[model samples]
Target: MRHTFAELFAPAIVLVFSSGCTVGPKYQRASVPTPANWETPQPWRPSDPKDTVPKGEWWKAFHEDQLEALEAKALDANQTLKAAVARYAQARALTSQAISALHPQMNVAPLAQRQRLSGNRPTSGVPITLRPVTQNSFTLPFTVSYEVDLFGGRRRNIEASEASLQAGAADLENVRLVITAEMASDYFTLRQLDSELAILDRTVATLDKGLQLVTARHEGGIASGLDVAQEETLLRTTQTQATLLHQQRDQFEHAIAVLAGQPVPGFHVTTQELSGEPPALDAGLPSDLLERRPDVAEAERQMAAANAQIGVARSAYFPSLNLFGNGGWLSGDVTKLLNVSSAVWAVGATAAEAIFTGGARRAQVKFAQAGYDAAVANYHETALNAFREVEDDLTGLSILNDAKTTQQQAVAAARRAVDIASDRYTGGLVSYLDVVSAQQTLLSNEQQLAAIQGERLVTSVLLIKALGGGWDASSLATARIKPTIKQALQP
Candidate 1:
């Protein structure tokens, strides 16, 4: 039995592809030295029996309902996160575009034309008069083409595109981490301000009663007018502080609104006093950062992409093969366009190689290698920065915890002093200025404690972000695959 040209070439094509001559060095992750333990000693250890770090919704560790809702809303509505997600989608599309080179490309074109030939135009060897100058022609053609990846340049391109998509996925996770952490930080700060305002409001009421008492005493010729004036001045000052706290609260509220992708005028969080200790976060071994941090994962994926680009560049050193086939029907009678008598077809192949281009190809290979090296360096830098962040937050939380303890003691002592000073002034043993000083000291201490608590919460969120915000590197493998609709919906 006779075979068509396509059938005859099939075995040769398979043999060439099966040789698997990938042009560049196989990819291996760049080696990075990591410490066996974190730089800062952590009081907390991973609760998981497997010693793995947290994954998925790390914010739930705080156990705050309002915070959980805010984080959820931010994930759903944040514009930055939406943009990152769109970029990931684009990367996935580009990867598919690159992969398309691995398969045959088919397209159809149908043509109908009427044209007139010039009667005076030259003909082959001898001139002849043109007859029936005007004519109608109709054809419908189907063409298929395939590039045989003999040296794997197109394969490397697909590899690079897949790696880029992985990097994009990691970037999306990083954005989600940032938005959620920002929302939590802003929420905590706003709550802290609310607590401070409540403290000031209570202080103002106490001063109000003191002012009335002193005013009555002055009118009865028992207390001096100077005492009444001092009490009034302290009350107004405390009120001013309340106003300041409200101002801070307003700013944080607006920031939270932006994070939640809501209009500032429409978004409002009810006044809830700050009340929570920073949850203990486990700092796993430094090596864990390779898998834990999304930024680090992104850096590593980009390095892989750059490495694949080197392969693509190196493959340019070899020749390329393109196979093409055309099948069509042509007839003067439009109704007979599909008839066997009207069939026309062609099959062919082209081999191309760049014999010389100065040093452009060599320079491209060098440039790709340089890019890979840079990406490797960036990966290392990202890991080192992650370690530094975890250390900073750990130390800050530890010191802040101690400072909060001391400030609470100070607040207690200041409260006792205010009580004792007020009794002494009532007994006419000291001027009311002593009581005012004690009250001011107490308010300062309380506000300082609240501020420290807010700092600890913010640091905790930062630490979570630095540690990779509940995403693990293992997910990169899954991300390389086209995501299902359910997976696409995930934040």
Candidate 2:
């Protein structure tokens, strides 16, 4: 009249899996305020995806082969990115471990032993019938144990782990974007330094010529020795600036080398002037940033993970249901261990409820709730910061563009002043001090222009990174568990 173990567990398994019932509060994404559009002096116009949005090889937009190559090298060899990849792999492995709890566990253990029975042992109601004896026994046992997930506790754990894995993936992508942007920024900065050094070299040459003229005029009593001294001072000062520019270029080149995963002593970028403008960027709807930026995606994923953990904690309030079984052969003789008559088998179920822990379960639920609230706050904060970055870049680009134009005019006026001062000094109409002042102005204006151009490029890179470097949440949809570096790097 008693049911077999399979019959007893069959209904429980069916009900647990098919009921579609889960404990704890269901998840709903926490909302935060967002602006409808970006505020800018120049209204943004929609552009074709090919022109605005970064696609594959975002660095290609810079139109620099060296920069593109550096980006590729960094993506492949950067140590920080590799570390992020490792963390993502670790998260994936943990997710798999959590998923394992949903399935039954099976293990095999074969045991053999010798036992001794004592005649002195107490019996029910009789005198001793035999002396001490020894016996040999053998067993080949297999066992299976499974939690029914009657309240979906294990399912919630799996959910949390999966969300964590996704967050880790987002982190990896964010690191990649940041490294690539850094490499590009350094590359452009080196180029700008080259431009500045070239300007200084030319300025120094011009000053040398003026110094020679002043020295000749002073020897003929047509100019004062003070004029010669002034010209020499200007030439030497310009030479010193050239030396400093060389030092800065060296530092920037070394940074590029490190980013490209090479020894600084051996790596170098060829001298090139900063030319060409950064590609145009479009600021999409503020709402779209939530899905585009990897940091925001990561934060949102953390929130989901925290929400699932809350469910996991709430499920602790219910008893756990587990079914276990073991079947094997046992006999006094090893040769008879496999015989049907020597077979032994058993099956059973267990349910454990936390009857007392003084309020531990409630505290855990509160802890999980607090974590969820923190995650939500973090998510909103990240989104707001992202918006701020985009706006900052937008305003910077507009202002820098205007400054570049003004700087160009200043450089031209300074050049004209230098020419006029030299002509007038040679004609004995003005003192040599005017020429020195003009030359210094020209050099300073040129350096400022070069710096502004470099900053514009760096800001462009920053904007691209803020826009997620062509990454999106869809990239994590497959949720594949990539364990090896080779697997992770695969396209």
Candidate 3:
């Protein structure tokens, strides 16, 4: 019997549609214990899901143009963030690798060689000739192979790879969030130090003047030598503290330069006291956490990948089909290698099924299922932790807001005490020691107030981070694929 090439392949082509249904169980999104609203009992509103333009740049809400600029530069230049993007692109490439399996793989080889036949070689105890025969050998061969994907194993693999690619995308966004948050926190801490330094500067100046006054009084016999010694000690101690502050500020400056991808040695941020009240932020609904949090989205995508892997594993139980074809021409004369009489061709298929294995196939299916369960557990844990962070940041901001006001009043009262003590010391009603104690108290209160103010700003930044910095999962959903190198390189 003879058959046409198309006729021979008709059954395999039909198997692609008929028996090629994906072998693994369909994936369902993992269930999550979503809350209707935030647990914190404060004035908060849900994020608008319809707001197409979510806070792509949430840092701008603080209204600091300098901060916004720094964030922009970090996004463009930060090495660590760039590494995350490269990893995402790598996953995209792997997805393409998996898809290539669906199509036939082809190869061609051309050869030319000279060979000498042993004419006197024994065959059936007969010698053809006593003389050697030399001949030219020329050959051309072509081959094709295809895995039929009859049980959908290749399709399942592609599904798994695609899910992993989306996970990479989410990871990219998560990295961006982490970097931006770090930059903001570092920037704020540096500004906080600036405010503290300003307070220290003023205290140092006051102590210096007080020391001069005491030294003059002692020289004229109006004040004790002990008063002069004590005043000098306080002034010198403040000077030492301010010197330490300068060191701390330099470290933070170096950190900022690294984050901005700049050389650290000459980098400097001008000393400016921290200003601007913490912005009022809305704590969106707990359900919004799924859409907004990139970590959450990443965990969920992992679950999908795991689910598809189960199908790929189960497909091992089915028979594997492979189509193979090889054709070649061979001739003693190179010029005639392409002649019809010198041509040879062949085509066929193989369907292989393991009749017995040491339970390896079963073990693989179990392994895949375990992976899926682990992914589900991770997803739940991630959501729970996200909720905890939001509540903690909200409580911190609330308590710190109250502390700032009380601290302001304490600083005011301390200043009044210092003024009264100075007057009394000059009028001989109190010793210079009493004035020194008042000055120390006032300085401490002022520093405490500055710290409280800085704490408020820090807490606000944390809250913004906990809220996912205005991210939305829909952006990942609509992406068909990062097909172009240009798209893959972009964050």
Candidate 4:
């Protein structure tokens, strides 16, 4: 019996050693065409390549202490981020479950029964037969089953599951980037509104004083009633604009509260002007984008998982090998269940091959291959889109910078025009209509300048988000938590 067992074990050992070669096509990182430099010139040079962007905390670039606090609060309290974390946990659990397939499964059963034999059945062979026999028995049995994985099918499944788990992690990071960007945008927008409101308030005050001057002049016969009415009209218009700005500011405040995971009714931010300059960023090389962007990394990982699925599908065409064994004690009497003579054991190997499946295996392989192809395409597309976003944002920032410069000059010129028009109207060198036109131009230019400044800041945040918010592949390497296969299979 020992020799026979050795022979069986020898063949199993050989099978295990030979199973290292996986059958399906191996995955290669898809090749993509990338440019050496961005089409738009970067104002800032790249930072130290060895220096890492603080992972999981990219909002500190704004240098706003309040913003930093708000981000920490949002990370801890936001419902959307919490949901993402839950999804990541679920994926990790699934990965562990898949890895468990590499190990054995065991079960135990303890049972008791009572039975009676028919009297007529035992009397056939005997000339004189007695009454029916009644018996009670108890048994304890243990069974174990294990798949040998001689074709690497289970290993491929495990690899796919691990890749999916990584994808989930990337998705979670992507969610964080999006949330932070949105919060920053809204915060800056609220500040812009406050600035606008301040400008409107001052404009209204000046217009009120002008209205009084026109009224006094009309009483002295130096100005007409029409001039006073126009001045009043300007004051009322400025007041109306201030009212609209207040409404906008309220809405933005409510949005910020929601983002901070606070109740709108209980949350409010004090009115403050947007005073910070836009944060400078070093746009890295185009090639580095593949490793830096979270969504791009996610797409690549999904492609790897899909490639592994093809291996799993192709495995269906091969035979499966399983080993099973069970041992127990059985007896007619419960008290005699532990007797050595009552013991029994079983051990067996099963080999199953698909004889015919009406081309189902072929169809499955085709489907899996198709899925892999689609994933590859999606990965390439996502990478390209990421590149496009960076380029577009770079171009936008450069152009907007120039626009801001030119618009500042325009604002200065408009202010001078307003001052001169006021002086000319008092000296009767120009009509009151000229003064109104110059004042309107000055207000519009100033508002545009404020809007452009806010937009530049918001776009910078978006650019940071597109760059994966200072996260990269190195972060992924450190963040990975290896899963245990053996513990997961215990039953």
Candidate-wise lDDT, in order: 0.85, 0.85, 0.84, 0.83
State the displacement of the C-alpha of residue 316, model 2, in Å, after optimal TM-score superposition. Answer: 0.8
Pairs that clash in candidate 4: none
User: What ranges in model 4 sit over 4 Å off?
Assistant: 1-20, 44-54, 119-132, 478-490
lDDT, candidate 4, 197-308, per-residue tens = 8888878888888888888989999888888888888889989999988999999888888788899997888877778877777788899999999899889889989999
Please give the RMSD of candidate 4 to the true structure: 2.9
lDDT of 2 by residue, 213-312 (tens): 8898899999999999999998998898889879988998888888888889878788889986888777678888888999999999999999999999
Candidate 3 residue lDDT tens string, 1-491: 99999899989877664467778889998778887876665422443444222377988777788888889989999999999999998997898778777657778889898989786666786644567778898889988888788778888888899888889998999999988988888888888899989999999888888988898999999999999988888888888888998999899889988898888988788877889777767676788878888999999999999999999999999998888999989898987888999998889989999988899999999999999999999999998999889889878877777788788899999999999999999999999999889988988888888888878877777887888888888888753353455443332
TM-score for each model: 0.91, 0.94, 0.89, 0.93
Model 1: CA > 4 A from native? 1-12, 43-54, 116-123, 126-134, 481-491
Candidate with the greatest TM-score versus the true structure: 2
| Candidate 1 clashing pairs, residues 3+ apart or interchain | none
Model 4 Cα shift for residue 473 (angstroms): 2.0
lDDT per residue as tens, model 1, 348-394: 98999999999999999999999999999999998888888988887
For model 4 the TM-score comes to 0.93
**Total residue pair clashes for candidate 2:** 0
